[model samples]
Target: MDRLSTRFKGTKTYLTNAALEASVNCALVLEKPLLVRGEPGTGKTLLAEAIAEALDMELITWHIKSTSRAQDGLYVYDTVQRLYDSRFGEGNVHDIRNYIRLGPLGGAFTADKRKVLLIDEIDKADIEFPNDLLHELDRMQFKIIETNEEIKAKYRPVVIITSNAEKELGDAFLRRCVFHFIDFPDRELMERIVKVHHPDIDERLVNQAIETFYQIRAMQRMRKPPSTSELVDWIAVLKSAGVTNTQLDQNLPFLGTLLKKEQDLVTYADQLAGGRRWRS
Candidate 1:
């Protein structure tokens, strides 16, 4: 099977993992929704963006929220607005399409060309939402009750769904999708990612930064380990500050970039003060 080994145009980051590459390709070939689950900051969302770029497809994203309903992704009917407009003798009030606004899923299904639909943070929505979405995902079609119209896909869009594992998805919903889990990047992978983002950064500085980053991530007490994106941010800051060495002892000043939680910060600080030497 073909792999998603090419660089994404928007991010210029290549997905190096063979499993991830194969899963993405499988989704494309089978035209099934790709369900990606991973820890926060592990590039789950970025994977969707990369797939869209790789295939040269337009990306339509539905960012799921706690209050998001499955219907919100298909279409929304504005009955109240239509009523008000009818009273005002509005020109388009009689047209059902005027009151019917297509949501991200609906838009994707109706697109003239194949596109990428990113359903981000699917776990944020209520349990029922995924089950509700299953039919449309399988059939690539939905009905608008407002107009009694059936909207079908002109070209099936590539669907990428991301979950941070905040809640367990129903087995029924899981069965419909091609699933994959993205693990945190290893040292070599992390280095490649850093270089992609910061091509001009010094190699010595990159090595030192990775070393220090791993040390902090290895801390058992850290409530939230710094993610690859955070590491990139930290390295960008270090590059700007001209930090030549990994100066583990004096690295406290840059701790804010790596560790976001206050408690995590305190724990790391304590570790540094306790004469925890940075190993090269």
Candidate 2:
């Protein structure tokens, strides 16, 4: 954890040994599911993305939705491909069954090699979805019930599941996973993250933005203040356009590039008018 650095040169993520050890254990040793719980925009999903990117592995992400069903985990057979095959070929039952395609999970398991499985925002998914995935997690295999044929994984990729802690998961489901909570980084760590993401951005701007975000954060009204990634977005966009604090007045329209909500933008504009140097 102490030695873990950002996988990408421009990445702001720096995980401690605790986080790294947990991930490595889940991926290589424990061979168990990892459940990451955190507040919104705390880089829970980014953890999985960074590991997959760092390892040069395939990233198979399932963005869990409220209606996501358990069966949707496997490969989605291209109906068009199946139909074409049926028309052109002898359409034997077994051949037709073989023609059906694999879903994301199925592909992850039975593909030519291993890949990272990011079940993102699992809290949005139905309870049955997690329960259904238990078997696959335990067995490292999935059966396409449509074909009544089993497909096993060549290698079980890192199974990283992220949740916003919106609801409580079943104890049985919790029993299958190694759980951890991701907290917001402190000011010093936040500055390190800023420099890591936007090397060319002036250090002053990074420092100012961090302080302003802290101001916004101090307000209890906002849903969530700017996070490290959002800070990256603001700095990256500003630098890419060659815009700086000196020219913010001329670039008012580009304010959209940084602040997201209209209220935040309004507040920033007011801050600028009060001679507070919002951009700087």
Candidate 3:
């Protein structure tokens, strides 16, 4: 945390501050999990990565998806596959137990030393999933059935959970952690973002892209507007392809980088064909 440059209120810097300072404070005094919420592409998951890097902690990230189950994170049981194999090979229950593959949660809980655990995108996961994590998260440990013993960490792992607000999580789950919400950065800070991600882009092009980005976002076309990532990618694509606003050809194929929707492409093409500025 002390190692991170706090001069900028940019998204990455804000996340770094929140993740490291919050986790260190929580671990020392509060002893709570950290829950981070933001829009997609706002760098919620990256917080743990930056924290682990700054503190020299090993990072273990488990991306939560629609089909993710509570037990899926706890342990990966391969007994079914083993049982099928034993029908052809030597038949034994011991071999099946031996083959049970440990999943991320089991591995993390059982592994020695502290680690940064990232439960990325809890909002996308099943409704009951977050609630089921309470016991394991609170205890900072879990029990593996095969071993018939509890796995406790000498140094409790820093747990960073990210949610995109796609859906609300249970109150029981949200109550378990210290929370942080990351809103999008302002223009000046966003320009710094463009600079951070596309350092080699021309200043004029960067500024133009940023201005156009805000304009397009304001339009709020049928599809969701482009994000900070798209703006950076747009600039990078422009520079790499040697495109200026004037060259025209270089910007056509890469409009997908700038505009993320079908209607947006049509709208942009219409604006370009009409020689319009696309001002809001």
* Best-performing candidate as measured by TM-score: 1
Poorest 10 consecutive residues by lDDT, candidate 1? 1-10
Residue 30's lDDT within candidate 1 is 80
* Tens digit of per-residue lDDT, candidate 1, span 1-280: 2323432233367655778877887787788899998778888888888888777889999999999999999999988999998999876887888889899999988888889999999999998889999899999998888788999998888899999888889899899899999888899989999999999989998998899899889876789999998999999988898878776764554788888999887778777777344342
Model 3 alpha-carbon drift over 4 Å, by segment: 1-29, 85-92, 95-97, 220-223, 246-253, 265-280
lDDT of 1: 0.85
Per-residue error (Å), model 2, residue 22: 3.7
**In candidate 3, what are the lDDT values of residues 1-280, reduced to their tens digit?**
4323222222444333444465545643455678887766767776677767766679998899899988787777677777776787755656545666766776677677667788888878888888888998888677767757666766667788888888888888788788887767678878877777766767887776677677666653336677777777778778888876623433554777766678777766655566444464
For each candidate, the alpha-carbon lDDT, in order, equals: 0.85, 0.69, 0.70
What's the true lDDT of residue 59 in model 2? 90
Top-down lDDT ranking:
1, 3, 2
**TM-score for all models, in order of appearance:** 0.91, 0.73, 0.78
C-alpha-based local distance difference test score of model 3: 0.70
